[model samples]
Target chain A: MRGLGTRTVLYQQNVAASLGLYNNDLKSVDILRETGPITAGELSKITGLATGSVTALIDRLEKVGYVRRANDPNDRRRVILVPEYEYKEEVGNTYRPLHQSMHELASSYTDEDLDLITQFIGKASAILEEQIKQLNVKKSKSSS
Target chain B: MRGLGTRTVLYQQNVAASLGLYNNDLKSVDILRETGPITAGELSKITGLATGSVTALIDRLEKVGYVRRANDPNDRRRVILVPEYEYKEEVGNTYRPLHQSMHELASSYTDEDLDLITQFIGKASAILEEQIKQLNVKKSKSSS
Candidate 1:
């Protein structure tokens, strides 16, 4: 299981390198794609990047046309990020092979077994997320 | 599954932050732990980092006492990395809570189910590694 996690990290870093972006930058984009439009502050919170760093990250991403920063209609002073559809498609292509292979792997399992696996993975991910939050909280406290 | 992967990445990024290490540095350590005493060149190849960057990486890890650089027994001029056992234990401690939680989660499953899940994850990791290699190959080709 730890081997699986290490491989996932390596895979993500390689993907980020392939796209000429930092691993964290790609990770931010990953979050944005799932989250739709969100404030820079929200992105910072989610990604564990500081506000200033998040601004730079958004600039670099915007410069590459992978993301857009637009004014929040309800709060004109605020800006929100949106992952460009084209950017998502282009990056999604790079993942196609892996997804295809995984899909095939899934096909070999019974639906009952798949449900069991899904439940296990979902619970495990929740555990990981809780741990990540705690680590970030600790990081902020130490830095301050 | 993708959600699990994303959380894993975020969890690892936070872990790296908590330890004052780059995510890649921690990742390199993870690989070194698995591979054991490998040459700097071998570590560079395994981690997809340039030789110069690998040198710097070794310097940093050595400075922190997480790794030691020594001449290879068979080739006195070549430096190899040996992950200090103390370093491993310290870093591994940071992951113990997650491990404990995962172990508890696993305890709920039958051995046959656990075997199936392990096989799936192993295969998925292989597919991911293959894709990572291809991306790295493409990156090098383009850079050259």
Candidate 2:
């Protein structure tokens, strides 16, 4: 599991480096992609970064044409982030090879087998998430 | 896959923060744990870090008592890194809960199912490694 985790991080690091973007930039963009337009505060909560850091993150992404900040529709004082579709499409092209390979691999597994794999993965993720929460508590306690 | 990858990175990050160690320090210690004693140059190659950065990384870990620098027995000028067993064992305690959970989860799967899962993970890791190599080439080209 640790080996797999290390490889997973290295893979993401390479992906970010290959695109000439910092890891946080990619992570922020990915969050925006998945959640759609959201407030800067919301992004900070999800990413565990400070609001100032999220603002800087958004600024960098906007500079690269990957994201933009817009005023909230309901509140004039509010601002939200939006992902630029065209820019993300271009970035998506870089990951096409990886997706294609994974899809091919998935095709070999029968639906039943895939179901079992998915179940296992879901349980594993839950375990990791729980552990992360516990670790965060430990982190906060030590810092305090 | 991306979600798991993100969680894996987050877990490592939290682990580092909880222990008051930097990310690279844990990474260097981890490399030593996995590969036994290795030269600083080999560590740099495996981690995609510059030689100078790797030297600094080793220095930091050595100061933490997690790793130590020693002379390579085969060559007078060469140096190797060894993980301090006691320090790593103490660190390992933090991960003991996680290892126990995973072990329990694995116990639920049949041997055949476990074999299938292992095969898939191995194949997926190879695919990612290949993509990383290709991405590195692209990164270098663009930078140069």
Candidate 3:
């Protein structure tokens, strides 16, 4: 399982390199795609980056047209980071092969077995998220 | 599955940060652990880093006592990168909690179900590995 995790990471880093983007930058875009428009503070929390670093990350991403900063309508004091759909569409092409392969693999499995796998994964993901939260807490405590 | 993969990468990056090491440095250690003693050139290919960068990466890991450069016994002209046991043990401790939790999770599954998950993961990993190889090839071609 650990070896599988490491390979997954390596594959992601390679994908980022292929698109001429840093891994963290691609990760930020992914976060935005998942969460929709969020404040820079939220991005820092989710990504475990310093607030100032998040600012710089957003700047670089915006310059590359992957993301844009917008004023929060409800709270003008806050800036929201939004992913650019066009860039997402372009990068989505790079992942087509991977998705296609995974889809084929999934189809080979019985629906009942797929459900079991999905349930297992979802629970495992929850466990990992909890652990990640704990790690982030430790990180912030030490840094301060 | 993609989300799980991203979380796995994020968790690893956070672990590296908490240990006062960069993600790439930790990844180098992981590669060394898996490949046994490999050459710097092989590390570069595996990591998609430039040869010069690989040299610096090895130097950093060496300074931190996580890796050592030794003369290859079979080929005196080449050097091999070896992972230090002590550091692996220390790093292994950091992953202990995660491993424990995963073990517990596995214990809940029946043998047949566990076998299915393992089989699915093995096939999925192979697919990802193939795609990664193609991406690396593209990256090298463009860079060259």
Judged by whole-model lDDT over C-alpha atoms, candidate 2 comes out at: 0.78
Query: Which of the two, 2 or 3, has more TM-score?
Result: 3
Per-residue error (Å), model 2, residue B33: 1.8
Comparing 1 with 3 on TM-score, the higher-scoring candidate is: 3
Best of the candidates, DockQ: 1
Alpha carbon deviation, residue B52, candidate 3 (Å) = 1.4
Pairwise TM-score winner, candidates 1 and 2: 1
- For residues A6-118, could you state the per-residue lDDT of candidate 1 as single tens digits? 88998888888877789888888888888889999999888787899999999999998889999889898988898883556658887887888889989999999898888
DockQ of each: 0.81, 0.60, 0.72
Model 3 per-residue lDDT at B83: 88
Residue-level lDDT tens digits of model 2 in B1-144: 666666677677667766778765776677678789999888877776668988888888888788888998999699888888445665888788899999999999999999888787777787776777777777667778
> Model 2, which residues run further than 4 Å from truth?
A72-78
Question: Each candidate's root-mean-square deviation in Å?
Answer: 1.9, 2.6, 1.7
The TM-score, computed over Cα atoms with residue i paired to residue i, of candidate 2 is: 0.87
- DockQ, candidate 1, comes to 0.81
Stretches of candidate 3 off by over 4 Å are A85-87, B85-89
Best by TM-score: 3
Q: Tens-digit lDDT track for model 3 on B35-143?
A: 8999999998877778998999889889989999999999999999988934566587777778888889999999999999989888888898788888888877887
Q: Each candidate's TM vs. the true structure?
A: 0.93, 0.87, 0.94
The B-chain TM-score of model 1 reads 0.92
